[model samples]
Target: MATGKKAKNVGKGMKGKVKETTGKAVGNESMEMKGKAEQAAADAKQAGQKAKDTMKH
Candidate 1:
């Protein structure tokens, strides 16, 4: 289900944001970078889904 996938991705993005913030607060560069990458991947997936939905209509 597209809706379910979209909601999951949104949650992933929010989680990534939290990870990135916490890493920064703790001075952990690796965790920060990983979080950033996760956010980027989630964003890309969301964009792809949006395009697919647009095409469907």
Candidate 2:
């Protein structure tokens, strides 16, 4: 069973990827930039979750 935070972070990253791809297909620069930011945010969150989980063990 994965931690909720980890799962959510993974979902967010996946969603961001979809958004980025869709934006590229449609030539929407703003959407693409937003998706990139979302992905970066999700990555940061996942890193934080990993650090927290490590401290618990």
Candidate 3:
């Protein structure tokens, strides 16, 4: 049972992956770069949340 925020972040990361793959398939460098950045940001956010949760335990 994941929290809503965590689920959202995971969803965002998944969407970013799709965008990156689609961009690459279409040969759109800018879109691919943007997607990669978005994915990184989402992953960082998720990691931060996990750290926060661990500290509370």
Candidate 4:
């Protein structure tokens, strides 16, 4: 896997977690939902990268 891309996905996942936690603490349902979506997208991206790397090997 590309180190830069992998780091980006990890960063996105971390960012989403912060957003979700902050939103919940502040009672912002919309923000929380957005955070969850972001996390899911990051997870998917990471999975795709892993699969691609596996195929290459």
Candidate 5:
């Protein structure tokens, strides 16, 4: 079973990818950057959560 934060991170990352694709299709640089940032943040958060889980074992 995945932890809550891990799941959330994954969901957020997926959402960001969708946004990024949409933005690119619409020629919106700002939205694309925002989506990229969101994906990065989600990745960072997921990595942090993984580290914490590892330390717990």
Candidate 6:
């Protein structure tokens, strides 16, 4: 089972993906780029957290 923090990060990443897709579908370039950036950041954060947790073991 995934921890609560991991689940939350995954949810956030999904939300970013939805925003990005919606923005692109609506032809809003700015919003689409923003969403994409947010998604990348969220992914990086999640990865970092996972690395940190692994080091604790």
Off by over 4 Å in 3: none
Clashing pairs in 2: none
Model 4 lDDT vs. the true structure?
0.96
Comparing candidate 1 with candidate 5, which one achieves the higher lDDT?
1
lDDT of 6 by residue, 1-57 (tens): 248878888888888898899999999998888888878888988998988988888
Error in Å for residue 12 of model 5:
0.5
Off by over 4 Å in 4: none
lDDT, candidate 5, 2-50, per-residue tens: 5777789999999999889999999999889989999999999888888
**Residue range 1-57, candidate 4, lDDT tens digits:** 899999999999999999999999999999999999999999999999999999999
RMSD of each: 1.2, 1.6, 1.6, 0.4, 1.5, 1.8
**What TM-score would each prediction reach against the true structure?**
0.93, 0.88, 0.91, 0.97, 0.90, 0.86
lDDT of candidates 1 onward, in order: 0.90, 0.88, 0.88, 0.96, 0.89, 0.85
Question: What C-alpha lDDT, on a 0 to 100 scale, does residue 53 get in candidate 6?
Answer: 86
Q: How many residue pairs clash in all the candidates, one count each?
A: 0, 0, 0, 0, 0, 0
Best-to-worst ranking by TM-score: 4, 1, 3, 5, 2, 6
Question: How far off is residue 20 in model 1, in Å?
Answer: 0.4
Kindly indicate the candidate among 4 and 5 with the higher TM-score: 4
lDDT ranking of the models? 4, 1, 5, 3, 2, 6
The TM-score leader among the candidates is 4
In TM-score terms, candidate 6 sits at 0.86
How far does residue 52 in candidate 1 sit from its true spot (Å)?
Answer: 0.3
55, model 5: CA deviation in Å?
Answer: 0.9
Q: Where is model 2 poorest over a 10-residue stretch in terms of lDDT?
A: 1-10
